[model samples]
Target: MSPGIPDRRGLWVAVGAFVIWGLMPLYWHLLREVPSLQIVLHRAIWCAVLVASWLTLRHGRGWLREVLARPRLAAMLAASGVLIAANWGLYVWAVNAGHVVEASLGYFINPLLNVLIGVLFLRERLSAAQWISVALAACGVLWLTTRYGDFPWIALCLAGSFGLYGVIRKFAAIEAVRGLGVENMFVLGPALAWLAWIELGGDGGFFSLRWGGWTDLLLVMGGALTAIPLIFFAYAVRRVPLSVVGVLQYIGPTLQLLLGVLFFGEYFGPDRAIGFGFIWIGLAVFATDGVLAARRRVVAQQA
Candidate 1:
């Protein structure tokens, strides 16, 4: 049987990556003692150190030489670097500010936003169901705004930042590790400069002198976890269909929602649930359309 064609392992790997990433907010919340800007700075700094070390081990000093050889690629990836930095900073800020649940909402909206990005930026056509999905998600967001007495800015920010990252990465051609290396370098300048100034006697409280002690060494693994899954995702993207990957992304956001509501004990009330309802219905439509369209393709092939 050969395990029935292990086709979705790559999809599963990507999903697993999202799950870990989604639940990461809980870990980020622990560093709440640090300013969100500083925490963002740490994410970029640690990511740079981790990726640089990997490149050093793999390529030795020539890693720098390789990067210098591709100045155009480096410049393009620099844009990706800014995108992820803003995404990281916003996510950490959201979690620390007690908006984990809303942050989950942002991820919920990401897929729908991706569709729009495709249409607007790439001039791609949207299916009827996709148009409906976008409308439903927008309506849900609007509903959340109406019920909550304010718009869910955290959710919107999360969706917007990550969605933009995806858009830019699509245009940037480079290997995963090399691309990430350059992207991290984009924020490294501002991140290191900010941290240095804070360390010079400002009240930034730069280092977590008591931060979970040696356990914080595990915290440094944050970059590894971040990068490894991305590598897996890049592999999976080439192997799996985008439609499958899109649905699988829900698993990660779902885990994040659970972690936010259950583990972190963030509040989730009726209005938010209603918003989730709208998003779910929209996904249901989008998924059904994709499945049926795939079936039609198979039938046409046979015909």
Candidate 2:
């Protein structure tokens, strides 16, 4: 199913996930007083628990035993595990540092990054419009860096890590839920060991939560949110065309922009405006090209 073929339900669900992710700064801000490392720990631990429970319930203990039996698959998942964990860590850090808007910018650039990855890794070709879009977006980013006297590290890190993760997962070949479950399982040992160390140390561990009761609750929500998106995304990826999914990704960054300006009080500089303007024009060209291309295909098929 392509965007050319209407799908209100899937569109809504995909949009919903992006909305939640965009508004994450609001939720993660509550944990600002907490250490970023502790936040990562909670995200990893709770997300692992949530996915594990789902797997156990759906496939029983046998599936887990099967994962254990496949040593090579386990190793591949372990590598993916680290990549996603790093992505999450970078995101959390960005959210905590009042860089949510920049983080959103990263995602806005991600589709173009995907296009680049396709060209580079998958030997996929981009149209002239697509190449121009990439160049414009890159120039926008560079303009911001020159104007601000520093690079948008958060934006670049978020996009680069995420884009690379998607590429890696493309090669991983595991089912969505199972893949996530395996990735979590691969990291569980190290996470548990870290928690254990935090507990035994004089610094405190399990009970040393900053928000106390609410922290655990939020952590659980984080895990469920983390796991559920993959389910819909996985479902959508299979059922829908890549073009549809690509278009849907913009919702997340749009939400974050609002959050940054409205909630976080980030100033909208003229340079950013110019940069974003370039990006908008570029994407407009790219999307128009896609729409026309899709239409031509449909018309040809009909003829």
Candidate 3:
């Protein structure tokens, strides 16, 4: 592969991952009858199983050994695991509780949050346009809060947790699949315990036959659904530029926003639109700055 040339296959893979993430609200909506906590537990447990199995098969325990050798990395993965689990649980609850629109808002805010995180924690400097973009996003959030007479905590929490998770992973310095596998392993104990308690207590949704085979299948497939896109993302990032990935990430939230409005039929009145419009403009500024920065880097490299 030439420098500055994207791998077409990787590009498609990245698109697939974002598309899956975007369409995930519909998947969770199917399990609306299941408790959000239970759904999250199932996701954690199954995702761990799938990721571990794949890692073991691919590297035959070498990856595990590599991760175990670095205690600091292991600890970082644990924190990231907790953050990701919280994100998953909250997102599921929000979707089933008819807050899909708000959930989408969280993801929409995530990239900007990532930028803020870079500035705050990583000591990375932001350009003037980047600062403007972040300010606009803040104003949008403020508009939504004051106009709607409620705080947008859901969006904030999601963005905060996921943004921190990304930062932690950035410092972890491990392969993405292996890092995720370790992260999930750290949470697997609690996840399994919760699942076991519910099943033993007869509160389990799986195999209850209440929602029938379809629900059971969906619950199990949750693991694959959780891990596969991440795998695709891992593959894509190695081959594609981070700027392209950043732009593509909006696909997921955009799809979620559409689903929340057109399919799930959540409220999207003029007020909401005005606030979102602000944030959208901010994202436009942010993304444009990123693309232009990437182009400058490429030009410098060519020179």
Candidate 4:
């Protein structure tokens, strides 16, 4: 509650959210039999139902109308919705296709990519240390690409789509929950229609039990899985410093990387390790600069 102290409850909440995100690969793995497209559709539909219900209860029907009144904001949310949906689809597909290591690489690259986005699109300037961090991350990607004889497109796409989504949301000027609710609403119709089409064609995994009752339950619970962490994140950011959040964000991908290598048994030879090492060093640099900058600002305020 003090100027510099973190709220203990918020820190825990932030940890919980990132942990859930980190463990998400396991959740999707449970639905491995279900097609990735179907999983994504179910996620979109159920998440929309839950989030819209919450918004309706909290702010009533007028909340949506209020957002729609701003055509520009609505359009931005629509664009963001498509990007997020694409991100979700790609992530789920990658996990099911035995690319979890590469997927984790995407999230690892995300924070640095966000910094690059700020510099390029927002015209923001970075410190020399920040520039070095970006360069290091770039070198990591290059190392993986050249050494492996394969481009890390899956990782790059995931980071790029999510990064652009963040940029759009930055200027959207809406509450996180409300913005997400609106975004879901934009995609809900198409998701529902796709699911319905599949079900009618008797190829759906939901009630048909093609993958059994547990699959059905997981599919439905996907909504809660999708929304709860985001809600927690929204709550946490309001209480904690951005620098703290920046550091905490890595917990998710770290767990994911572990799950990929340890649990999923994906390949991780020395070549890949060297590349990841470069990125990890870059992240360390970026995080240190962020903390020092935050401390400087606090000291200036106190002085």
Candidate 5:
């Protein structure tokens, strides 16, 4: 294959992954009948199995052994694993509990959160436009908080957990899929125990209940749903430019917002609309700044 062929393929692959991620709330919604915690447990267990099997098939036993042997790495993975599990559980719960719109809002602000984290913890400098974008997003969030008469705990929690997960993963030594597989391993035991309780306590929906074959299939397929996009995403990042991937990342939350309003019929009154508008403006500025900066770098290199 030509060198450019892989890049072209990766673009499509990345788009597919983002699209899948964007529509994931719909998948979670299908399992709304099952308790969110139970669904999360199943997701952890099944995804671990899938990723482990894939790792073994690709790299043999050495990969797994190596991951386990590194104590420091293992510790980081464990922390990251817990954060991701918490993120997954909460997102699923939010979707099932009809908080999809609020959940979407969290992701909408996540990029800005990353910027904030960079400034606060890493002492990174932001451009003037970037600062303006962050300020607009902050104002949007503040408006929502005041209008609701309370903090948006669900949105904040989702953003915080996922942001911290990214931070931990940044220092991790393992590769992406392998790292996720290892992370899954850390959570597997608790997930299994929880599943056991649900099944043995006669309160489970997997086999004992009369849910239906479709539900069973969907639950089993949750593993694929979880891992496939990550695999596609990993593949894409290796082949595409970071800026391209960055822009595409918005697809997930946008799809989620649409699903929330159009499909789930969640509230989108004028007040929330105004708040989201400010945030969108912030994202527009942030994205435009990134594109312009990237373009300037390219031009400088050419010059």
Candidate 6:
């Protein structure tokens, strides 16, 4: 495909990925009975299995060889693996513990955190509007903190881990699928160990007649749940503009927010609404600036 040409198929694929992510809370909600730690352990194992299988079939070990040969890349991926695993574990616990709204808030703040990382670590400059957006988001967080009488650590942790993960991957110079495959491999060992311990304790969920077969199957499907959207994301990014992807990324959090309020019947009082309103205003500025900037760049190129 030409670099600048838009493809409908790619757009659909990307949207599909974000939609799956948006609706993912419901899936985890179904497994609320399962321990969050165990759920994450299974997620790590099955994600590794699925990703590694796809990588092997697609390239017959070429990508793996390349990754292994690069010690720095492998080290970076190892760190990323740990971060992503923590992120997954935390998110699972948060969802199961009925912190879905806070979880969604984390993702909402993630893009802004990413911008902050870019400024701090990459020495990138931000526009005035961008600065305003960041300030608004900070105020929003403060609102939430004040209302809750404590720091929104769950939101902060999720944003921090994922934002840092994005930073590491930004410089890793690896393909998305392969990078994820390698990262998952690093976590797979611990995941297997955890599962073994659970099994030894006679609490393993796999093949348990007590837990319906459907539950067991859904647990297995966790691998696909983890991998498929990433695969779609990988496919989409190659074809779509970065700006488009950035906008589409919000779909996940939006869906999570709605699901929290409507489906899960989580709290969303006026104070919380005001806090979210501030954050939403910040996001509006951020997204508008991004879209306008992208358009200007495009127009300048054509000129």
lDDT: which candidate is best?
4
Report the Cα lDDT for residue 139, model 3: 94
Candidate 5 wrong stretches, greater than 4 Å: 1-6
**lDDT sort, best first:** 4, 3, 6, 5, 2, 1
For each candidate, what TM-score against the reference? 0.88, 0.91, 0.98, 0.99, 0.95, 0.97
- Model 5 CA RMSD to the hidden true structure, in angstroms: 2.1
Q: All candidates: CA RMSD in angstroms? A: 2.9, 2.2, 1.0, 0.8, 2.1, 1.3
lDDT string, candidate 6, 72-110, tens digits? 999999999999999999998999998999999999999
Which regions of candidate 3 fall more than 4 Å away from where they truly are?
none
Query: How many residue-pair clashes does candidate 6 contain?
Result: 0
Best prediction by TM-score: 4
List runs of model 2 lying over 4 Å from the truth.
Answer: 1-4, 65-72, 208-210
- What overall lDDT goes with each candidate model? 0.77, 0.78, 0.93, 0.96, 0.89, 0.91
Residue 24 displacement (Å), model 2:
1.3
lDDT of 4: 0.96
Could you tell me the TM-score of candidate 1? Answer: 0.88
Model 2 reaches what TM-score against the true structure?
0.91
Which pairs of residues collide in model 4?
A: none
Ranking by TM-score: 4, 3, 6, 5, 2, 1
Candidate 4, residues 190-209, lDDT tens digits: the string is 99998899989888867764
- Candidate 6: worst 10 consecutive residues by lDDT? 1-10
How much is the lDDT of residue 149 in candidate 4? Answer: 73
TM-score of model number 3: 0.98
Which is the winner by lDDT between candidate 2 and candidate 4? Answer: 4
lDDT of 5 by residue, 1-303 (tens): 432224788899999998998899989988889989989998999999999999999999788779878889999999999999999999999999999999999898998898898899878999999999999999999999998665888988998899989888888966899999999999999999989988888888786556787988898799889999999998898897776777888898999999999999999998898889999999999998887787777777667
Task: Pick out the ten consecutive residues of candidate 5 with the lowest summed lDDT.
Answer: 1-10
